[model samples]
Target chain A: MTMALAGWLSREAAVIAVPVISLAFGCLVGYLAQRSGFCSIGGFRDFFLFRHTRLLKGYAALVIGAFAAFLVFWLATPAAFEHFPWALTSGLSPVPGAPAGLEAAAYIVLAVIGGIGVGIIGVLLGGCPLRQLTMTSEGNLKALFFVIGMAIGSVIFSALVQGWVVSVMKGIAW
Target chain B: MNKEPEERTSARALAKTPVFVGALVGILAAAVQGLLASAGGPEAYGFCVACHTRDLVNSAVNALAGTSLTVAPISKNAVLPFLTIVGVLIGALAAARVNGEFRVKKGSLTSYAWYAAGGVLFMVFALLMGGCPYRVALRVGYIDIVAVIGLAGIVAGIIAGTKIAVACVERGE
Candidate 1:
């Protein structure tokens, strides 16, 4: 089958196939996320607000599953090591296009500020972006709006503040 | 312990199962991601909620600027996170269905608006921080100390939000 298909398409087609498969996988996972009610933000919110933890369990399950898959892939496939390098350094010189390394202190500050926003918004929205997607699949019309809003927000951040981000990051210590 | 009615499982019990399951799932997802990364894919990340969010951001900016660049390279990376998210939805839907918890109820218009606004806020923060709550936790599990700080911030934020929410509820405003 591989030989027959190879004959039909160029080498580029074969390379593109990986992403095609990945998209299909993404859609399937999106569907599953919609069904599962597994939002990390939601899990934390519930724990604090209602003292519930069902959503947290689902989160745990996903992490466990991914870890197991990683270990197996690592052991069985020599190529896997290449993808998961220990220190992601590509030669003594930093990659030309790589973002400047921000200071650790800056990272902490940004993370804290951003995290607060994320937490508050997530709770207000009843879930995180992942949860919103999952909720949409489960037939929550509201979540659809949330997704749209997220897209819009992403646009706003990138278009308006990317320069600022680069500058801020550059000024910070790595 | 006193047994409540059959329909009433304690919150504590319900919480335990899901947390356990979520942690396990998270670990598994990370492992697969690591493997995929090692196999000539991205490094130190197989799944990143915030990175994808940035991709979305980039795509949108390019589109508005009339550039040919696609904002989200969703098609170019390990999309397992997207899949896992979908899985959660399906799982939730199935659970809701079986438990007779499925309801087509509508919340207040104000509530819906708030939710949308909140989503926007989340996107902004996620892009700024370079990861979402799930990614933060996953990074922590992988022993990324930086992620631990993010997690701490997230928890602190949650506590603050909860308090504010309670205050709002009490005020009925």
Candidate 2:
């Protein structure tokens, strides 16, 4: 079912506003993230190694804040969040960002594999994607390379890895 | 004696902390939902690094190369691709410049190669899981069971990564 949000702008205006609003929002996020030196992967690594809560608190607050905001917005605009509390509504099915048309078990497998890879890579690289982006702006050439890799990776995934992974998972039926 | 004043000062400084910044990001993401949901669906998609990067890169590529690569519906339906990453680079650059934190740091060619490789692997895995760490938080907030599982996997991976990091350090390579 397609969602229809009681958005602030009409469809025509919203389409026009998409890039503009996203850019502005990105700026705000980038600015604050730079100031705070925020990194989700670093948070986990620090907490695991040193029992530090400083960065961990940031990550935790993000989850809590998103939950609070989503709840409030969903209540105010039901159509916007037709699947509010996704666990109750969608069950084991994931949000739509991953490969589509997989069973719950396959999704779980993909999530685990993907999550582990992300964590390992992020920790090894010293930050998450947001942190990498900010570091690139800070004139870190290594981070720049990482961001460049991501740009290249995007095309590669859509063109190659995505199809291969989906087919494999479907073939295995796991 | 002076403890109360010190505590108060630190409390005031909390506004500048990562915790506060994270909270702001979370709320603004929801605000994006309220403001732009009419643009398209994909519920908890108000903010994401990996996915949005994919959207921006693929859209630009599609337009330029005339290839029918995929992008998020919001980006596809919009007049242009989502420019969050561009904004991030520009915004962070501005912030760093203003704060006097922008400095050119170089690394060895070998390290650069590793990092570049890491980036490719990272993006691919993040997309496989469907989002980055930030989007995982949002999905968890939105109460997706799979995301919760993904979070667990991240924790497990962190533990494993920490071990590898420690091992590498001890080896002095």
Q: Pick the candidate with the highest DockQ.
A: 2
Please write out the lDDT profile of model 1 over residues A114-171, one tens digit for every residue.
8788877777667777767656655677886777677677666665655677697776
lDDT of 1 by residue, B36-151 (tens): 33223333344555555455445445556775332333223323223333344455565556556566656678767876776677777876666777666555444455555667
TM-score of chain B of 2: 0.90
lDDT at position A81, candidate 2: 71
Once model 1 is optimally superposed onto the true structure by TM-score, how far is the C-alpha of residue B28 displaced, in angstroms? 5.9
For model 2, residues A83-114, the per-residue Cα lDDT tens digits are 88999988899988898888888899989999
Which prediction has the highest TM-score against the true structure? 2
Per-residue lDDT tens digits for candidate 2, residues B40-150, read 867788889999999999999999999977698888988987899989998899889988999999999998898888888998999999999999999999999999999
TM-score of 1: 0.69
Displacement of residue B112 (Cα, Å) in model 1 is: 4.3
Per-candidate interface DockQ score: 0.27, 0.73
